[model samples]
Target chain A: MTAVAGVAMANEPISPIAPVKEINLAQVELGKKLYFDPRLSKSGFISCNSCHNLSMGGTDNLKTSIGHNWQQGPINAPTVLNSSMNLAQFWDGRAADLKEQAGGPIANPGEMASTHTLAIDVIKSIPQYVVEFKQVFGDSEINIDRVTEAIAEFEKTLITPNSRFDQWLLGDKDAITATELEGYQLFKTSGCVACHNGPAVGGSSFQKMGVVEPYKATSPAEGLAAVTGKDADRFMFKVPTLRNVEMTYPYFHDGEAETLTEAVDIMGRLQLGKKFTDEENAKIVAFLKTLTGDQPSFLMPILPPSTDSTPRPQPFD
Target chain B: MTAVAGVAMANEPISPIAPVKEINLAQVELGKKLYFDPRLSKSGFISCNSCHNLSMGGTDNLKTSIGHNWQQGPINAPTVLNSSMNLAQFWDGRAADLKEQAGGPIANPGEMASTHTLAIDVIKSIPQYVVEFKQVFGDSEINIDRVTEAIAEFEKTLITPNSRFDQWLLGDKDAITATELEGYQLFKTSGCVACHNGPAVGGSSFQKMGVVEPYKATSPAEGLAAVTGKDADRFMFKVPTLRNVEMTYPYFHDGEAETLTEAVDIMGRLQLGKKFTDEENAKIVAFLKTLTGDQPSFLMPILPPSTDSTPRPQPFD
Candidate 1:
């Protein structure tokens, strides 16, 4: 298909990340409020945005997240941008979809540290939330499922479109520098595209972290093996998206790599079994930087106030 | 001044809050990004918005704030909306202005737990922040002064104006219900108007929490006494704004009162030595609800990504 630049297009492995054009605006609006409302957490301070912050490439930029009661998270937070493109959610592919993934943090003991019952009760108590829920769901029935569904819908709209790389793919040669173009070529020719080829440039499938070498990490997570109960699934993780990888740093599930250069070095050694020259690494890093795209822009949602009937947030308790 | 829905105008004791008409858009925009950027916190999880959230009446909606290491704050976090109207900042009036007040939480061990040095270092390390700071401040120099100044400036734009009560004060006869009008009259006849009269309906002066009678609260905070060495300042708090009191619930310095009616009851018994009937209290509560005004509406700022040179956040360390 011809792109906006009217340049001849070929069958490219990676597709352009498309901007969200149509959605249930009411549901999206409701979800935006829920996403920012910290009352969902037991501490009455942590919201979904606390970890997956839209301001910072939809990630907290933390090695491992600080959660309720200052509990350290087990794994690094994955960026929420273009996350809907993932075949399955989470590093281990435990959750089936975005909706299921959305529920994990709120209930997790180390995360939001809130019970589903308490969360539902909090929303139900707010008269304004009740009215909005009725308007969006066609009834005043507020439940965890509906809450997650709306949140997931809002997340789907967080796709970052029109990156410089996408422009280059659309037949504008000047979109990227010569070094970035060289990096792109090397990334493809070096066989890194096999697993990292998709609209999201990764997340299409689960892959072993260290194909050529045994990976050692301090985390106790067994990856997909914990979910599938298969010994072969150990150390297998859903490849994270490379889109906006420049911003979502401290890479990998363990968050051992602090910089892109270090991460690229480790990946070259462990995954590809190729020790690339420093120049080659720099070129690839330059290309990765081009993945930074247009972030979603929208008015901050004004949440409805809690009334006397609403269950008060137990921040201290 | 003539108001819409023309009615007889008079010199009201309280002036209607006016919307912000003039501002440095560039600085305001930069400040918006900084406000939402969590990287300023030591954990890189808490932001200024974490406590002064724009979504929920610019508060975390907890009786007391939750801070670093999950510490329970000593006092309630006041709403950021129309806070610029305060004669001075904080319950104790310790900070001379909003800019000074902005610096307190970031360094407070119980709050963000980030030092000014570290916060400045973090901002200075980010190349994009450097650029934005130069654009807004006419120099690349990044400091706590500029950071807090920009934040306070953006905060000035957070004034919520055009409440139904404000409309009523501007000669719109139908802006308020008859019961609400009666409630306002009672509020004046009682001594509440003495402390709560200004453009913001309060924040004009400091007053003792308990004037005629003793107030028993669990909080150990002595209000202005903590700021000043004088014992006479004990329990003297800067009267909080009544604007948007409906949304800023769990009223008072200690946040002991969970509802407006309860707050009114306590204020009457302690400050005025007069307990009102249930009907009178309900009318006051209804009138207070009319103070809910137009919340600030603005696009959520998308923060620039941290570069390789940027200092990594120490969430765990």
Candidate 2:
């Protein structure tokens, strides 16, 4: 353990407090541009924003993420907002850092499906990109590492830390309403705290979906089974942060429920083995809305030049 | 001619500048939302910005504006960047004011191609849009006239003032480069100033293309012929403003030339009956670039709902 000095802290960092890194503004700016560019995708239609859109709670409101081939992924799209806070990346903790996460979608057969050489070539083609890359990377050559670092820097800046929950936690009593406060009390008492109780609310841990009642798994996704290749991990998935959960719907590993009310009821039944009345559900829904904070005008990273100008095709087109 | 009682400008106003009505921000904001909205188009795909995009110099880089049914217009899409100052509307000057101009596109068979009634109905269908219309119009009821008024108000805000030319006029010596200053002098002396001089640089007047050189009958467009059906008006068209001309490329009414250099050569040969050498062309191009000023972000009046899911398209089906 002593041999791997930083590796021990890598999994469970000394506090949820972030370790500050001197960021390159140039890289962040370039990442902002690349994040908005659709050229990164094979079809040139599926931008990073297509799935992890900032305007829409950082996740496109789809049950499963639609990609270049219009092929839907098994799991719901994770919100990119505050994703920098994650100890490990992806629903099943596949990537150890943001840099690794950045390369995942580009080569994913269902997603961007772009080779590294092709992605770099496409980016180098744009005059604006050329100027920006030269400014950001300096004498260092432009490649996948630089691309990942730029994107990672940009992801770090997407920390939405001033929500009402944060304000309430910061001792602003009036930040949350009385009903929302009561719902918070109910949340703790109902034993939802088994997995979801942290600064990110739930991303600090993972839990099996059918802890009490069978989750009645309807999604085509085998949930965490694809990642673990274990039958026991079949229904297991990451416990998503509820930071902006109100805006990100339908809820769950597969976006089966359209509204928070239905999702809360399902959670109560499956996760806690508690049946809630309609009035209780309404109160929880009201509490969830308070979690949805105001977002600033998203200056859409200038739309990257696309190879094709058509709707994304599906099923490995 | 002295028919109207309160029209004092006709007799003699102290200032030659007409008293234009101030723009209503509330209406302009509404109009801006409507302007960028693809829902206004039949395919629910195209918006005003689809053609007059801001990032790409207020005009889509396409040779001609594409519309519904993939039909291409004969004339190049003019920049809305600073179009508010134009004396008349469109290449042929058919529309008298911004309101009339705004109305023309929606109803035009080759443009948005929606009737005012259908447009309003389409907007009203979206609950968020319905709320925005109510807030802006004050229950005045959604109508074509209101749409025109809102769009006109928005267009007034699209004014691109304070170019290097404006700064130079204001006694800023370093506002424009030395080559641009020399080019300006040449522009004035070359008899090009006969019609291409005004507040908007060229929007204040109309002129016959190739006035000195018997107007050609070879271009794709018959200029003002389509509007008036008069043989004399065949080659007559409004001289476009050079405000953000550097960005809005493929110049001229027909977008015949691909670059500013080529456009300059063609204009010198056909209109001025003189040839501009490479050095002279470079100077003129430099001067045109200096005309570009910073374009502020067009603040959309209505925002999409906080939810991640875009309200599904229900226009056609």
Candidate 3:
């Protein structure tokens, strides 16, 4: 982690996750249905939940996601658990917001593999969705913008608050163990806190993958360089939020590190130019585990059935 | 809906769907998780919900299902909602119960494409599941039998009661309109109720696909003949429950019919040596729409993360 911004090494660099109170319930409810609806994809088998699954820390729990037609994704899909906190979306930081990011996967050939027109057509064909759009947006129009907006609104509600760390931050003395507290101390002193500090614990900035040394990326993705077309931006990616990181495994952009211990060791050697003892790495890992928050518990949305007019899913095609 | 038994059709042929009272809560909960778990598959992509999608009337709303590696399913997927009322499971009635049916898809090459051993191994590797199995089964052992039993218990709770038709059956005069009431009368008088009786409106009997005439099946599945190896049993498939038939589209074993009217028409011509008028078909379709019940609204369970020892899903492989 490198490009530290928003929160300097102030008195409280890492803030406790605040509980959300304000949200348009109708919009959120509509968005939840759309989020789980796979008909948005050409295949009708892959929904937004396909990659960013709510069950397993908002990730598909795959190293790299299996996409449309079983096409292998190049990079490890990021968790959507607290993704709203990210400065930008994607490993390349190409999309500026969740709404913009929502549309990318639906059309991406290696992802949901459906174009905007096709998705809109499919959604509009379902009468219930048309009604829902009218109710949410005060119009009967079903367009890509509104669709993405609804999805983004739903994503906004995906904030995971009240981890043991947050409880500790709020002055609960026994919230974390002594070893975990020591780990937190080591994490701050080792300079890991510089970039990985925020309400989300690491999503406010784009940072080079290997700050101290060159990282041997297993993926072909060039991170921010792919977007910026600058050599300096190469290997730079949006620092992923560490909230519920315990459930999101096979760590890093390439998913090269399968375990937290391996990931911690790699970060130490590459990001901070420091080698940690096995005990030290274990301590840091324990601290990271404390970041596991209370996951969002929502009823599995019941999607409206497709009508005769609705275009059929050409999954094999 | 043929070979009606259990219900004599003496006083009331079609009974109101009774509200469920007794169910194994712990087993049901555990089963619900497993039902939604895609890790049972080789790809780790397809869950039981993929085909029997609870969102869309417990059916995928596809003609046939799209399965492992996007292999097209041979028959239309039956709704899991109220599936417990069915006398037997699967289109051909090959599986005697939900437990037996649950095991079929896991190993089915065209479906989930994972062995029972592989699925059990995956479940056993996850510590949370191991603990849950112990709680539910009174032991820490993870096996296919207990796994399927829990799934069966969960399926048993999938009984969807309180449809408008059920309300109408329970003496609510305004629960249905004149047109729907007329259609229900026609359904009984025209002999449609002979097969599709009982609380499920179907199930409890095996019937030939085409009783009066031959049907051109879209897929090559042999129906009951494949299991029994008897020429007399050829095309004799289990009658699908018409519960939530509105959502379970592209009706029949072949999934060729796209609309309820079309399915009704075909059934008249092929099964009853009759042709339904357009108005009659519409009426029946309207009455069928009244069968849509309150879908199971359960909070999406947060599944335990896979550990290093867990076998990786090989979608491409």
The prediction achieving the highest lDDT against the true structure is 1
Error of 3 at B75 (Å): 2.4
* Interface RMSD, per-candidate values to 1 decimal: 1.1, 7.4, 1.3
User: Judged by DockQ cut-offs, is candidate 1 incorrect, acceptable, medium or high?
Assistant: high
lDDT of each: 0.88, 0.68, 0.87
Docking class of 3: medium
Give the per-residue lDDT digits (tens) of candidate 1, residues A126-200: 888899999999987999999999999999999988999998887777999999989988998888888887789
- Report how far residue A162 has shifted in candidate 1, in Å: 0.6
DockQ of 2: 0.11
DockQ of 3: 0.70
How many Å off is the CA of A91 in candidate 1?
A: 0.8
Q: Which one is best on DockQ?
A: 1
Cα lDDT tens digits, model 2, B1-317, are 23332243232211122233666778877887777665566544456766776545667655566665445666778888668778889988988888898887776778776667777777665567667778888883778888888887887777666677656664566888899978876776766666666666678777788766765444567767778899888778898987767667667887766677787778878889889889988888777667766564543232354333334322222
Query: In candidate 3 chain B, what residue range of length 10 has the lowest lDDT sum?
Result: B1-10
For model 2, the local distance difference test gives 0.68
lDDT of 3 by residue, A195-280 (tens): 89889999898889888889997689898999989999999888888888888887899888888889999999999999999999
Residues B1-317, candidate 3, lDDT per residue (tens digit)?
12232232335678877777788899999999999899999988899988888888888877778888878788888888888888889988888899999999999999999999999999989998999999998888889999999998988887778888877776666888999988887787788988999999999899998999998875887888998999998889888899888788868887888888889999988988889999998888889888888888899988888877988887778
Kindly report the root-mean-square deviation of model 1 from the true structure over all alpha carbons. 1.8
